[model samples]
Target: MTAPPKTPHPLLFAPAASQGSVPDTEIGRLFHEMDWSATPLGPVEVWPQSLRIAVSIALNSRFPMFVWWGSELVNIYNDAYIPVLGKRHPQAFGGRAREIWNEIWPVLGPQVDEVMQHGRATWNERVLLVMERNDFTEETYFTWSYSPVYDDQGGIGGLFCACSEETPRVRVERERDALLQRAQGTVTTLQGWFDNAPGFVAVLRGPDFVFEMVNRAYYQLVGHRPIEGRPAFEALPEVRSQGFIEILERVYREGEPFIGRGLRLILQKEPGGPLSEAFVDLVYQPVFDVHGRVSGIFAQGHDVTEQVRAVEALKEGDRRKDEFLATLAHELRNPLAPIRQSAKLVKTPGLTAAQHHWAIDVIDRQATHMALLLDDLLDVARISRGRLELRMEPVALSSVVASAVETAQPLIEAKRHRLSVTLPAEPVVLTADPLRLAQVLSNLLSNAAKYMDDGGAIEVQAQARPGAVAIRVRDNGIGVAQESLQTLFQMFSQVSSALQRAEGGLGIGLALSKGLVEMHGGSIEAHSDGLGRGAEFVVHLPWMQTESLEGGQPEAPQGQAALRRKVLIADDNHDASTTLAALLELDGHEVHTASTGNEALALAEQLRPDIAILDIGMPGRNGYQVASEIRRADWGRGMTLIALTGWGQAEDRRQAVAAGFDEHWTKPVDTDTLQALFATPGRAGSSQAGPAR
Candidate 1:
């Protein structure tokens, strides 16, 4: 019931007639010849295996090969195509090329079919393709070259293809393309950011170091069109003449980045024209190419014009500060010298009552002047730092003005200038700080007197304006400059250069006065024509009344009887001790003198004086030590200890208080206050003594 398969005859292996039959024609012989030894065909069997051998040889070859039949992709074979097919078996021998790889049909099928139909050959490179293999997997690359195959009848039968598998090459090429695209995008973004950056940026290239790229700011700064692709020397030839080209050359040669800040660059519109200068901070960084070869330089910078100007302003302020301090020291020391000399002269032991009284008064007035100067200095510092404290009270404007005038009278008398005052008969009241008001008026008056040369006249007048009171201080003195008017209220800002030499000041007085006036809801203004003319300052303050009026009377004056008691003075300076003793004696007080704190303490315990004035700085046992010893003494119960020294700082006063002194007074003591302290009713004529400097 089963059928057996038949076996082939041995004779069938022998060469057949088709294999042995050689063509007599040259074309037939050529087609049948096997020139390659690796081919699996004998010379006689080549004809029968011609088509098969040709197809096999083409498949094994490195070149891509395909066959098309008239407008249709029939067969394709290639060694390079093996990998593209991945793990797929070679069973794809006779499939429709288009159907197997339809994804690439749009590009490869259309072009190859056209060549076959038209009987022509076409070649291309970098031709793109996306196709699926026999396994239905996607592949993307390029295919090229199409040659039409003709039949024996001279008609186009099919097309043969030879191409290189460009997938790897194409992928690499796409990556390179992406890198270039990204680089371009980065450059664009950098350009935009640099254009608006606070600093300038530029790119320079070439042996001549020309500017190749410049941002918007660079163009604006250069004030000219960019010179791209031009040599730096040629584009900015003027720089060569100005030595800037040399700097660039040095940087380039060293292959190092260079940075320069606060460099002054003067740019002129035309040669020999006035230079418009600007300060700049700059950096030049070397740029390299793909091969790491130096290609050009990139420069970035900032314009520091404003910064330079501000520094100049600060320098000017420092200069004014120095000048003011020097003037202050000179003015304060001048009065101290006379007070010391007069105090020494009064101690000669032959002084009459009138002469002694005059000497005491002179010492008192000079001491007060020094105190006022120190007060002004402290007030200026406080106002500058916004630390000025005001004691607000209902004040009579007349009293404030009168006090200020009285304080300035010595300076006025020294100048012998005509002084006039005009005040309303009716009282003008204001809710203000009395001491600060007096200080403001005093500063204005003193400033006027200091500026006037040869004792010029001064006028102080006040009037009621709409909702305010206007106080005017007019003086015939060297006037301020027009250019300085705007900065008149600026601290440490002096007048123009011309006026600084004529009238010296720290430039803080007016500034402090202005701030004080404004803090009280008021404004101040300065008016002047020019130098050698006159200046007038006007202060306008709001007029307001305080509600409370009780407890407004001035305190009664202290008596001078205590000042007439015997007083002992001790100090290291013989002139200081002797003059102080004589000055006390002139107040109708018996005086004894010692040259040291120990001597004064000894005399104080033995004499049991009413008061003791101690000098802080002494050779042995300083006045503070002396005062402490005296306060602890059995006879020191009612004795008042006063500190009189050059150490006038606030902390010094606090230390003095802690050391048991009743009051602290600086050197060049005001004789009037000293006399009044001694003259108090309960304390007057009591035995009091003081330590001297």
Candidate 2:
């Protein structure tokens, strides 16, 4: 043994143990114990100077560090890197880098090759690595750097690495980023809602009340001025004197909210324009900072100028109504006084037969005049309340004209006006309410007679036009002023001069005529040059061709009987169902009724009725649910489903249609309307009752 020690080769000799070349650590001890001859780098003593220095540096570092050397890329690491290795620790101390980290070799292999082949350094931050640790793959993150170690000949020999696990910090940062994204999304959504808010919304900041934010409605209220970032009082100087600025100041100073209801403010809506008054119902809520000190104010309100003006108009209307009532009383007393005198005269004894007859005629004429006035008033009221029912039927234009002329002949002859009637040679037929049309025509003719001077020329003409007929009533009379034409068809509206000349009228004839014309899907207009220029009233009515009227069963003709058919009524209210069933029975239709959605479905399946009128709000499943279920059945596919609900809003109709209903009808639907539905062509005795849902 002494001879062998004396003969030891200097090239393979180990460094002195006392020299402490290796780090005095766990990985250092393992590195010292590992046999380096098995690796491509061979023994530690034979390692190149550059690699020795790199390994020494890696083993001594406080941070996790590693060394990959030689063509095999053998692994060498410090004590700080042991936890990174997990169960591969002691065994992985001096093993091949790619073999020891084969699971992540694909990720790190290229990076190592780059540094080794190019002699360049590589740095990566928060690089993700799924590594086997504690006998299980763990999700971890790390930041590391790889620098080439040069040999004595200035050639790349190995890689020196320094790293730190970033798993906890990286995960925390990712979570924070996700939270921030959600918060940002919420802010964006809130901003959208604020911009589209219906009411005027604004925010003011600081004691000067600078405009910080404003919505679309606010911009409209303020006339689109460039007011953002400017002081409220400075931008809207018109509002300063109106006490709006003071109100905002008070809210900001005292931190107390103020609700202003119908506050009147005079503003200059346009630059250099006249000041106008506006009313607003608003609230000034103080916004506080972190210290609970008032920072600004939030303002939201509605422009109530129309409401204020409407209240004033209502007051004026009440005064006008009072005047009208007084006039009515005086007019009524005038007729009553004459009737009383006539009655007394008839009752007097010793009166001649002629005198008695004259007195009786006076009473009769006055009573008839009073009855006429009451009838006009009643008609006006009924039309205003939408209670006037039109009995629509096929009628000849000649017949309507004759009926009107007969009604107005007494008035025309009494006025001694020269009248002319002209019509198209070919007879014109229309689907119209004959009586209503006659009434409209007669009212115009009577108006002409009443307004015209005696012996004035009156002309009634009817001409055919595409899709309509034009009926014109022209008269040489005390014509209406241009300003009066606009309101001539309004209720209780009359030209003052015309009223004076005509002696007496309720000022509703033209209004009633217009209403009647509109109910027939027509329009009426009056034209005149000016006072004493002769007025003309024209009515335009939609007309049907003679062939269509004669060939087909009347389409939606008023009061026409419907074909016999099967009908189902589903409603929760017993009275509504019973009454509707009775009406259908009267219309000659077989009917079945149910009070619940489920019962309706059962009855619908059993009968396969042609029509299903269902109440939207029903017990058990509701009408919408029942309608959907019925629509799924083969037998129920062709049935017409009508949604009969008290809710008649446009949204309600949309929901009903979306729920598979063919029609949406509001409660209290007219019997005639239902009859019209059944009378429609292909509505009964056909596989399909209505338009498919």
Candidate 3:
């Protein structure tokens, strides 16, 4: 038997020179080696025209194509389809479709069977395909089509498939999903930090102060009430009346921070909860957006109710202490008058030389010392109670320094201390009381003199600066200790050693000076390079920017002292009243005395004295009432009323004015002061150009 050599399938071979049919692909070469006559489809030339045409189209195409041909529905695919078949290539190229695709058969069998059995076409977009590739099942997606091919009988023979894998696109979406999860985890950790913070923190958006974010502390602060995505006023209505709303709006508009310490606010946190008072130290800071515009506010603070309540509890004790100091000052002045009177009385012409020297010593050493001590105590008490008031005027800083230097010159000379003063050539103007301003400088100078070695040098430098004037009183004396500097300006605060205590002050000179300086809208600070290294005190006062002084000290009134006038004096303290009357009579003025306010009123009506010095604390009617009565009388209208009181506080002076007094003086009113009042040319209720010191 002679076996004829098998002819290879024409569609799989390289295109011949005349035909130009087969593609140059792996599948093309494999198709020529494939024995189709032994399989169900048989040889390519004897195959039905429709089947042959389908095979020709499948093998020659460049796309990933497959042809399921003949009644057995055999598998056929191109070179582009080998990657999709995975390990099933070559063997699957000629096998039955159902047998080759057994793993994904449930999904692919119906698409194939419908097209082949019913002669209909089927399409699938992004269909799932679990296929073994490289000996492992891979999760893949594909877009595929199955179109029917007809035999010569006009019946469905097989399905032609065009397919593509969508695996790469699906894998990218999974990676994106993982990234989103990680971002959410980071946000959660940041939110956890905010929740556990100690202070109440909240973020509010816009000028409305709407709560956009809140933490655990903030929630507990409002009694664990839910508050978010709502305006602060609407969520915490109690804050509206406390001006919190206004502060928030202002901070948002101006981009400035608003702080409130111990701010009392009443809130009803829970339903039916009683309105409770809360004191918080809160700050409203502006929060800007990415565009650099203020978009919200960051509210944070702590509750301070306990601290505020403790301060409120101590107010009554403070009041009683002030009263005790006032009484102590009044009692000390009682003995001072007799000592002063005895000193003056011993100065008579008949006295011996020894008695004269003794009297002079008593006057110089005892009386003056006692008087100054008493005055310092009274000044400190007044300052502590906020009773000191400044009579402000714009005067040259040079003039003020000059006056202050004069006040301290006596002590400076006694100590043989070298003093130098540097003033700006251009005048520096400040709105302050010339008397108080001078007192501030004098106190610092005296303090320096007392603490330093006897001959130490002191310098007073006044420099002009923008918006303020810096007056520095520096001394090459015993400098302050580091611990003492902090309490130097506190009333009753002293840090002198045993030897330094002999300076004979109440340790309140700096304290009083600080009070007066502050009242004039200035600040005082103490600086030192440690003990014995020299000290410097700098005082800065807000200065007026003008070429000239607005107002200044009034000049002394002269000639009126020689003019005699009738005066009425009244006092509950007999020694004070008689000594003052005797002093007035020494000035060649006729004087009358009364022990009570009623008696003074009667005397004023009866004698119609030119001047009336009414004692404030007297039996029966008070001096204020007596003054009121005297002013009502037609004959007493022209009388010059003066109020004398141990109570020389600002309020007391104001009351004196209300009572028709021309001037007011505290006790221990020196004879010179009394004489000066009459010398100033003015009646009651006139301008205080030059009154008693």
User: Which candidate ranks first by TM-score, i.e. highest?
Assistant: 2
User: Where does candidate 1 have its weakest 10-residue lDDT segment?
Assistant: 19-28
What is the descending TM-score order? 2, 1, 3
Residues 301-333, candidate 3, lDDT per residue (tens digit)?
887887888787466335434643554454455
lDDT of 3: 0.79
Which candidate, 1 or 2, has the higher TM-score? 2
Q: State the lDDT of candidate 1 residue by residue for 1-693, as single tens digits.
A: 898987533222224344323233322233344342232222433422323333444544556555544334445455455565555424343446666666666776667667766767888786656555545655566656777666546776666667676879877978999999999999888878877776778888955787777777776666664466777667655556766676777777777888887888776545466668788898888787798777788889988988998998889777777766677676777779989977997996989989898888888778876776676667777666666656677778888899889878877888888899998776788878877888789888987888888679999999975478999999998888887787888876666543455445556778889888988889999999987788899999998533334567477585425435667666778888788888888768887777777788888888887667778888778887888787677677567777878665556766787677777776667777787777675553232443221
Candidate 3: stretches off by over 4 Å: 1-354, 357-361, 364-368, 496-501, 550-554, 558-560, 681-693
Q: Candidate 2: deviation at residue 691, Å?
A: 33
TM-scores for all candidates: the values are 0.59, 0.62, 0.52
Per-model CA lDDT versus the true structure: 0.70, 0.83, 0.79
